[model samples]
Structure formats: structure tokens, C-alpha cells
Target chain A: GGIITQTPKFLIGQEGQKLTLKCQQNFNHDTMYWYRQDSGKGLRLIYYSITENDLQKGDLSEGYDASREKKSSFSLTVTSAQKNEMAVFLCASSIRLGGHAETLYFGSGTRLTVL
Target chain B: GDSVTQKEGLVTLTEGLPVMLNCTYQTIYSNAFLFWYVHYLNESPRLLLKSSTDNKRTEHQGFHATLHKSSSSFHLQKSSAQLSDSALYYCALSHTGYQNFYFGKGTSLTVIP
Candidate 1:
């Protein structure tokens, strides 16, 4: 079994600061995704990439940018941190089967706290 | 637009009791895939159950869910609750050839001994 690794288990940033989160997967999956987890809000998709160098926005992509640098890595950047904004960012990868995505394998997540 | 709904924000039950989590969805596509994911503290959220065929029941890890197209629901259930069952549960939906997924607000279940 492969694993998805996310760097920086915790992050603390100041208002208006830019922060980036990185993810790497060994599953060799074709698609990668970034999701934001908030209390009582579940997980909201921020961005997803079907292939390397491809990016697609999701329902909650206003303040985030994503990059799929390679087949095994996906990254997300917070344009400007908001004060007291605290959330967990998750990275996931999945393979496409029969024209649709299969089960997603996720990272442990990066907890972000904006001060 | 596709969307998923999980009504209960929190559920507290005694061990050995039954487990039931409600999940409903709305989508324009007739062929939809419904999924149940469990998220334990400090761990990644993982797929607990998934179903695409209408009226079919899927089971995994002692958890089961049936996809009822007529009712637009896929509810997760178990015969007995355990302490390890306590976690956050999310219901998700996706359509054919769609890479984007819609997830519910989530329900947190706590099984007390």
C-alpha cells in the first residue's frame, strides 16, 4: 500500500501572510485534490488536478491556488491569511476508473492557525 | 449541481447499541455515486462505504449503507456500536465523469461505554 504525505503538520501565519502546503503521494494516482476542513462544515474542495500541470477550481476556491507540479506531488497556497482563521487542509489522490474517480486516499492534514 | 446532506451534527450512543447515520443527497444526474467517509481524530478520512447501484447495499468494516435512488438516500448503519466507532462521518456525492465532489456538513458520533 502507498501513502500520502503532507508536510508541516501545523502552521501558524500572520494576517495577510502567504502560506503554502505541500503534498506527495506514492500511489501514482492520476488525480490530486486539496480540501479545507472546518468545524461543522465538513470538507470543502478547494482545487483538484486531473493530471500533472492541470488545475480545476471547486466550490470553495476563492482564496486558494493549487499546483500539480508532477504526478506524485500537489501543492496549495493561501493567498492571504485571515486573522483567527483556523482550519485543516487535506491532500488526497485517486485513480480514475471507467471515466470516473475511484476512492480517494488522503493525507493526515496540515492544521493552519492564522494569528 | 450536486450536493450531500448529513443532518446530525453530533450523536452520542452507548456501546453495544445500534448505529445509524442519516445521509441524503440532491443531484441532476441519474447515475450518481454516494460515499460514506469516516474521520478519526489525528487520522486521515477514509472511505467506509460506497455505492452506485440503486437499491444495493454495501458493507465495510462492520458498517453498511444502502443506496436508495428512489429516496435519494444512503444511510450508514451497524448492528453494534463500539468505542472505536467514534469519529466524524461525511457523506459525499459524485456523478459520471465528474472530478468534483460534494460533501456534507458531517456528523460526529461518540460511542460511550
Candidate 2:
């Protein structure tokens, strides 16, 4: 079984400061995604990468940037942290089989606290 | 565009009772796939069940869900609720030939002993 690892499980940043979160997956999946989880709200896609150099924006892509530097690693950056931006960020990876959507494997998530 | 809605934000039940979580969705694609994911405390969210065929029931780990295209709903159900079943449940949707997936707000279930 493969695992997705997220670094710095907890993060504390000052308002207007820039923060970055990193993710790595050993599943060798072709697709990687970044999602934001808020209290009382489900996970919302921030960005996804279909391949090592490909990037796609989701509905909540604003104020965030993502990069897939390698097939196993994906990184997300918060341009400017806000007070209300305190939430957990999750990373996931999936493998498409026969051109069909497959199940997603997610990391434990990084909890961000902006003060 | 596709979106999922989970009506109940929190569900409290006693152990050994029945469990039911409502999930509805709206999408323009005909070949839409519905999914149920579970998130345990301090654990990463994972797929619990999924179905693409309409009217066909799907089950996993004592949980079941059937996609009803006519009603645009895929509600998760379990005959007996257990303390171990207490967790956050999320409903998701995705269409064939697309990589994007949409998720609902999620329902938090707490089964008291």
C-alpha cells in the first residue's frame, strides 16, 4: 500500500503572510489535487495536476498556487493568508483506469491557523 | 457544473440504531458517478462507497448507498449504527471522461453508546 505524506501537520501564520504546504505520494498516481476543508463545509478543490507539468484550476483556486514539480510531489502556496483562511488543507492522488475516474487517496491534511 | 448537497449537517444516534444520511446532487452530465467518503478523527478522508449505475445498490464495510438518478440522490444507509461508525461523511460526484470531482458539505455522525 502507498501513502500520501503532508509535511508540518500544523501551521501558524500571521495575517497577510505567505505560507506553503507540501505533499508527496508514493502511489505513483498520475493525478494530484489540493483541497481546502473548512468547518461545517466539505472539501473544496483548490488545484489539481494531471501530470508532472500540468495544472488545472478548480472553483476555489483564487489566492492559491500549486505546482507539480515531480510525479510524486505537489506543492501549494498561499499568496496572502487571511484571518478567515484558517482551515485544513488536504492533498490527494488518484490513478485513472481505462480513462475512467478512480478512487482518490488523501493525505492526513495540514491544519493552518492565521492570526 | 456539478454539485452535491447533504441536508443534515449533524446526526446523533444511539448505538444499535439505524443510520441514514441524506445526499443529493445536481449535474448536467448523464454518466454521473456518485461517491460516499468517510473521514475518521485524525484520519484522512477515504472512499467508502461509489456507484455509477443508476438504481443499483452499492455496499462497503457495512454501509450501503444506491444512486437514484430520477431523484438525483444517493443516500447512505446502515441497518445498525455502531460506535465505530461515528465519523464525518461526505457525498461526491463526478462524470465520465472528466477528472474533476465535486463534494458536498458533509454530515457528521455521532453514535453514542
Candidate 3:
């Protein structure tokens, strides 16, 4: 069994400040994803990478940027923090089998609070 | 476009009672996968069950769900509710070979003793 680790369990940033969240996985999966979790909104995909150096935007990718520099790591950056905003960012990795993705394994998540 | 819908935002039930969480979906593709994920406090969300075959039921951790393609529904159910079952539940949908997966708004269930 492998694990997905996300750095910085909690983050506090000032309005308009730029913040980055990091994720690392030991599963050797081919795909990684970044999702934003909001109460009552569930998990909304921000970005996903099918392979190293590949990036795909999702429905809620307007203010976020993602990078997959290595097969085991994926990072997400918030361009500008919104005032009084609070949300949890999750990192996940999955392996594709038979032309479809299998179950996703997620990290504990990074809680962000913008002041 | 693919989408999932979980109607109840919150459900409170007494312990030992039956548990039912509604999930519905929409996708243009005929072959779609539906999943139920449970998120406990301070823990990452994990898959509870998933199904792709129509009219077939999948079970895990005492929870079960049946995928009904005719109705576009995959509802989670359990015979008895426990306090440990209290958590946020999400319904998700994915099509064959599609990298993008759609998730519902989620439902929070609280089983009180």
C-alpha cells in the first residue's frame, strides 16, 4: 500500500498573496489531480495531469495553476488569494487500467484560510 | 458533459435505523461508472463502493449500492446505521477512457445514538 502526502496541513495567507501547495505520491500512479473542497459544494476539480509534464484544466481552474514536474509529485498554486476565503485543497493519484482510471487515493488535504 | 446529483445536503438518523443516500447522474456516454465516496472528519475521502454494470449491486463495509442505468441512479444504502457512519458522502461519475470525473454536491449524514 502506498500513500499520498500533502505538505502544509494548514495555510494562512493574506488577500492577493500567492500560495502554493505541494503533493507527493508513492503509488507510482500515472495520473494526479488537484481538487478544491468547499462545504455543500463537494470536491471540484481544479487540474489534473495524465502524465509527467502534462496538465489539464477543470471546471474550477480559473484562479489556479498546476505543475507536474515529476511522475511522483504534483503542485498547485493559487494565483491570488481571495479575501475571507477558506477551503481545503486535496491531492489524489490513480492508475488507469483497461483504458479507464481505477480508484483514487487521496491525501489528507491542506486547509487554506485567506485573511 | 457528465454530472452527478446528491439531493440531500444533510441527513440525521437514529442509530440502528436504516440508511439511504440518494445519488443520480447524467452522462452522454452509455458506459459510465458511478461511485460512492465517504469522507470522515479529518480524513481523506475514500471509495465506499462503485458500479458500472446496470442493475448490479456492489457492497463494501456494510454499505451497498445498485447502479440502475434505466433510472440513472446509484443510491447508497445500509441495513443499520452506526455512529461511525456519520460523514460526508459524495457521488461521482466517470466515462470510459475519460480523464475528467464529475462529483455531486455531497450529502452529510449524522447517525445519532
What is the per-residue lDDT of model 2 for residues A15-114, given as tens digits with 9 covering 90 to 100?
Answer: 9998999999999999999999987988999999999989999889999999999999999999999986679999999998767558999999999999
User: Under CAPRI classification, how is model 2 graded?
Assistant: medium
CA lDDT of B21 in candidate 3? 97
- Error at A29, model 2, angstroms: 0.6
Q: In model 3, which regions exceed 4 Å deviation?
A: none
State each model's CA lDDT, in order. Answer: 0.94, 0.93, 0.94
Per-model DockQ: 0.82, 0.78, 0.80
Model 1 - which docking category? high
lDDT of 3 by residue, A46-72 (tens): 999999999999889999999999999
**Per-prediction TM-score, please?**
0.98, 0.96, 0.98
Q: What does DockQ come to for candidate 3?
A: 0.80
Which pairs in model 1 have colliding backbones? none
lDDT score at residue B34, model 2, on the 0-100 scale: 91
DockQ score for candidate 2: 0.78
